[model samples]
Target: MNPRPTPSPFSPIAIGPLTLKNRFIKSATNEGMSAQGVPSKQLVKLHSALVAGGTAMTTVAYCAVSSDGRTLPNQLTFTQSSLPHFKALTDGVHQAGGLASAQITHGGCFTFIRERSTKRPLSASGGFNKIGLMSGMFLKQAMTEADMQQVVREFAQGARLARQAGFDAVEIHMGHGYLLSQFISPMYNKRRDQYGGSLENRLRFPRQVLRAVLDAVGKDMAVICKYSVTEGVRAGNSAEDGAQIARMLEEEGAHLLVLSAGMNAESITTMFGSSFPKENRVQQKNKIIALAMAIQRRKEPTVEFRELYLLEHARKVRAAVKMPLAYLGGAKSLASIEKIMAEGFDLVAMGRVLLAENDYVNKLESGASRDSICTACNRCVAMMYTPGGTSCVLGQPGDAVLNSQQAASR
Candidate 1:
C-alpha cells in the first residue's frame, strides 16, 4: 500500500502571486448576510472568525456583477456604489490573516428567484425555468449575438471592479446553475447559434466570459472558475465532459479551477448539497472519485487541489493541466482535511462549517481536527433566501433572519 500522500490541506499553496499559509479555504458562501450590496458587520465578524480559525484564505463570496445577478436583497454587488463596501470586506479578511476573494457572479435567468425581480431571467436560449412548468409559464428569451456580447462585457467589467476593491482573487460563478453555468449546460443553453450545440459551441459563452475577465483583470489578481462537474440531467453535464471543459478554460486563461457538482435546477441534491447523505443517489461521489484516482496515479501534479469528493476531478485536471486547483463544499473537520491531503489534493475549503464555527481554522490548526463540526442542516443556506441575513437555524442565534423574512412576508 502506498503511504497516503502528503496531507493536502496543510500544504502551502500559491494562488497566482498570493501564497496561502496552507491549503484550506473558506469556500465562498453568500451570507444573504450582506447589507445594501456590501459586506456587513456580521460578514466582517464571520471573516474574522474564519481567519482566527486558521484557514489559509477566505472569500468575500457572492459579489454580483450586476443587479440582476444579485440573489438576495442585501447580497454584495460590484457596481461603483459598492467600492467602499468591498474595500472594507477585503481589508477585514486580510487583517484576519486570510486572503480575501470575491466570487463575482451573475444570476442569468435564475437571479432573485425568491424576490419579485424587476429584471427578467435570461438564458442561452428560450425556455421556462420551472415558472414555465406549464409551457406558457416556462417563458424564456433566447440570447441574441448582441446579448452574448453584452454578457461578455459585463463579466469583464465585474473582474476589473473586483481588483479595484482589493480582492486577492476573483471566482467566476460557473457552478450551481448560475448565469455562466446555465450558458454551458445543455439543459439550460439551447441556442442553435454560436452559443450552443456541439461541445465547443456550447462552451463558447463560458470561454468568452473567461477571456473577458482575464483581459479585465490580467494576472494582477487570481481568476478562478467554479464549475459544476455534472448538470444532474439525463444527458446534460458529465464529469469527463466537465474536466474537458476545465482543460479548455485553463487554455483560455483561467488561473484556477474550482470543481463542484449539480446545476441550477433548485434541487437540494445538487453540488455541495449532495455531501450530507441527506440526498438519495449521492451524485458527487463517483465523478469526484474517478477524477481523484486519475490524478493520484499520475507522475506529475498538474492541477492544484484535493478539495472535496471532487478530489477526483482535481486530480484528473492536475494530470491534464499545469494549473493549480482548490476544493470546496462540506469539509468540516481537520481529519477530513488531512485525509484529502493524504489523497494528494492541494487544498480544502468549507462553507457552512466556517459559518457555524468561524474559528474552524484556528481549532484545526491547534490540533483539533474538524471531526464533528458543522451540522450542515442548511439553515444558513435557507437564511439567504429568507432576506436580511442568513445563519444556521439550529445555530446559536437560531434564525433571526428567518424570523425577519417571516415577519416581512407576513
Candidate 2:
C-alpha cells in the first residue's frame, strides 16, 4: 500500500494577493448582529472571538449589495451609511491576526423587499419563494436587462466598498439559490431571453457580476465565490453542471471557489448541516416558518450526518477548475481536515463547528481535542431566525427564550 500523505493545515497558501497562515477559514454564516444595515458591537465581538480562537481568516457573511437584496431585516448592506461599521469589523479582525472577508450578495426574490424597495423583488422569472411567501412576500418580477446591469454594478460597488472598509477578500455569493444562483439554477430560471434557457445563457448574468467585481477590485483584494455542486431538486444543476460552473468562474478570475450544495427552497439542510430540534420552532413561535419547514422536510428532509459530506462532489469541482478550492461541509475534526488536505484541497472551512466552539481551531492545533464537541443539534440555526443573533446553546439554555422574545419584538 502507498504511504499516507501528511496533513498541512498550518501551511501557507495564497488566495489572490492574500497569503493565509493556515487553510482554516471561518466560512460566512450570518450572525444577525447587524441592525439598521450596519455591523453592531455584537458583530465585532463575534468576529473577534473567531480570530482570537485561531482562524486564519474569518468571513463576515450575507452583506447585501443593495438594500432590496437583504434576506433579513438586520442583514448588513454596502452603503455610505454602513462604511464605519464595516471598517471597525475589518480593523478588529486584522488586529486579531486573522484576515477578514466580506460575503457580498443580492438576495433577489428570497428577500423581504418591501422593507427596502418600492419595486418588486427581481428574479430570472417571476415566482414566489415559499419561505418568503409564507412570511408575506406575495409578488416578484422577472429581471429586465437594465435591472441585470444594475445588479452587476451593485456587486462591483460592494467589492469596492469592502476594499475601502479594509477587507482582504470579498466572497461573491453565487450559491444557496440567492440572486446569482437563482439565475444559474435551471429550476428557478425560466426566462427565454439571451440570459436564460441554456446552461451557457443561465451563466450569463452571474458571469457579468463576477467580471464586474474583478474589474472593481483588481489585485487590491482577493475575490472568492460560493456556488453549489447541486441545487438539490429533481430538475436542477448537477455535479457535471457544477464542474462547468467552476470552470466558468475560474475563467472569469475567481481567486478561490467555495464548493457547497443545496438551494434555498427545497434542500437548505444540505447547504448547512441540519438536525433541527423541534423545540427551537416552538420557542420562536413563527407558525408560517414552522409550516414551511414541515413542508420542506416532508419533501426533501435533512441529509444524514456524514464526515466530509461534500468531499466527493467537491473533488469533481476541483478537477474541473484550476483555482484554489475551499472545502465546506461537516468538517469538525483534524482527521477530516487531514483527509481533505491529503486529497489536495487548498482550504477547509467550518461553520456550525465554529459556531458551537469558537476555539475549536486552537483546540485542534494544540492537540487538546481530537474532534469538535458540537452535537449538530442546529438550535443555533433556529436562533438565526430568532433575534439573539447566534449563540451556542450547549451551556446556556435560557438564551433560547430570551433570544426568541427579542426576535419577536424586532
Candidate that scores best on TM-score: 2
TM-score of each: 0.81, 0.92
lDDT of 2 by residue, 103-170 (tens): 99999888755765545678888866554666676777899999999889999999999999989999
lDDT of 1: 0.66
lDDT of 1 by residue, 1-410 (tens): 22435754655777766778888777877665565566665666667667767777787777877776665455678888778767776777788777877888877666434443333467777756653342232465676778778878988898888899888888898888777777778777777777788778888888888888888886788888888876655657777777788788888978777767775443324455543221212222334223322332242222222225455545555556556666665566666666656655566667777777777666766766546456665546545544445565545653344333311122
Off by over 4 Å in 2: 1-7, 115-118, 127-132, 286-288, 396-410
Q: What are the lDDT figures for the candidates, one per model?
A: 0.66, 0.81
Q: How far is candidate 1 from the true structure (C-alpha RMSD, Å)?
A: 8.8
What's the TM for model 2? 0.92
Best by lDDT: 2
Off by over 4 Å in 1: 1-8, 113-119, 131-138, 273-319, 385-388, 398-410
